[model samples]
Target: MPPIAMPPGLKLAQDVMTPAEETELIALIEGSGLAYTPYDKGNTRSSTSYGWKYDYANDSFVPCKPIPEGFRTIAERAAAAAGLSCDDFAECLLNRYEPGAVIQPHLDKPVWEHVVGISLGVPTTMVFREPASGEERPVELSPRSLYVLADDARYVWQHSLPPMQGTRYSITFRTFSAEGLRRLEACPAEI
Candidate 1:
């Protein structure tokens, strides 16, 4: 396949975390004691939200558990790598994907703006598609690597993960958009 040019505002950094850090993050996720709920087809993708929970069933956002210290530290690094401020990140989501689990193509909620994601445990390819044009691009994500989606990449294209070779965990951080900020101000958050 021909190499696909990355869309504007999409950035990826390789080896953002050391193997030791990756191991530690995985351990922290395992010990966090947060509820992981399955929301995808066949119950293959389970996730827990921090700072704010996204109600997939209702397609709305709600306040949830605060971001854990371990994740917060990494999120800060991710924010810096993405050229964003850690303070701007208001939500964190941890997704656990079982082998062969797939995430269908879809855009994120408009309430969120920039997105930073850290990949762990397994390597996988994320395919981004332009809905109107149907043009697709595939980006491989290695364990401990980080990827950022903003601007056109965040709003114009839809992204999804194909079936994986092994269990994988993605730690995602998102910043609230103007609309999200307004909503946040109106809602009483847990933290």
Candidate 2:
């Protein structure tokens, strides 16, 4: 498939992480002891949320296990590479995609302004669809690469990952909006 045309406010950095860093990050996530849940009711991928998890049942953000320290460095680097502050993000979601797993096209919730994703283990094609025009494009995400979505890319397009041939992992970092933060603070769960 042809690679996607780059959209405004979208940035992709290939081979952003060293092999050693990737290995260490993988080990840290696997050993973190946080339970991985299905991406949704029946999605093939499993994921664990850190810092905050949206409670669909409650329609609010709730606290989850804190992000591991090992991931802090990765987040910092991603922020710096994206021209964002390290403090800009306060949550992360780590997804593990087994072979054949796929994520359907969907826009991220409006609660976050930007998203930074780090790909690991295997390369995969991420598809983006323009909401109004419905034009689709594909972007290859290589192992140890980083991709950032902000502004139009974050709010106007929908993104998805196609079924993979090998296991792959993605760490996505996001910052909560002020209203989201207020809702998080009002959640019954302790932060």
Candidate 3:
């Protein structure tokens, strides 16, 4: 295949975790006991959040269950792959995509800075689009691989996933932007 021009500040790292680690994570996620809520245009996809969740009505992130200890090592590794420290991230979103599930094209919320996603289970393609140029780039996300979106890729491009032939899971970590930090400090001590 010819080289593809990826958006600036976008990074992809393969084999971030061993197959055994991936299986352990899947087990942990399955047993987390968190309810999965519908996402995107239709109710085809579902997700659960930890550390923090965006409150659409309030336009701020609210504290949710903290990132579980079981995921600490994975999170630390993901942070290193993104050239950041684990403490830099304040939110973790777990998504479960059943066969035929899809994610509509959209940018990450403005209050977020860097976004890192670890793909697990079945492999799938993530499409990134530059709205101004009407250009779309497709990147394959293999199981256990990780991707990071920062700067232009995180702010200028919109991304989505098409319907998949098999089930997949993603663990996404996000850092707060300057504005997000302010809003986070204003959050109540208890949720």
Task: Work out the TM-score per prediction.
Answer: 0.91, 0.90, 0.93
> What's the true lDDT of residue 22 in model 1?
94
Badly placed stretches (over 4 Å) of model 3 are: 38-41
Residue pairs with backbone atoms closer than 3 Å in model 1 (clashes)? none
Q: What's the ranking of the predictions by TM-score, best on top? A: 3, 1, 2
Model 1 Cα lDDT, one tens digit per residue, 1-191: 76789877899999987899999998887666545465544757777778887676766678877787787678889989877888777788887788888888988888888889999999999999998999998899999999999888998989999888899988999988888777666666575
lDDT of each: 0.83, 0.81, 0.86
| Residue 118 of model 3, lDDT score | 94
Q: Which is superior by lDDT, 1 or 2?
A: 1
Better candidate by TM-score, 1 or 2: 1
lDDT of prediction 1: 0.83
Tens-digit lDDT string for candidate 2 (1-191): 65457767789998887999999988876765545453365555777788887766668887887877888889898888778887777678887788888888887777776689999998898888898998877788899999999877788878998888998988999888767777766777745
Regions of candidate 1 where Cα sits further than 4 Å from its true position:
34-41
Pitting candidate 2 against candidate 3, the one with the higher lDDT is: 3
- Backbone clash pairs for candidate 2 read none
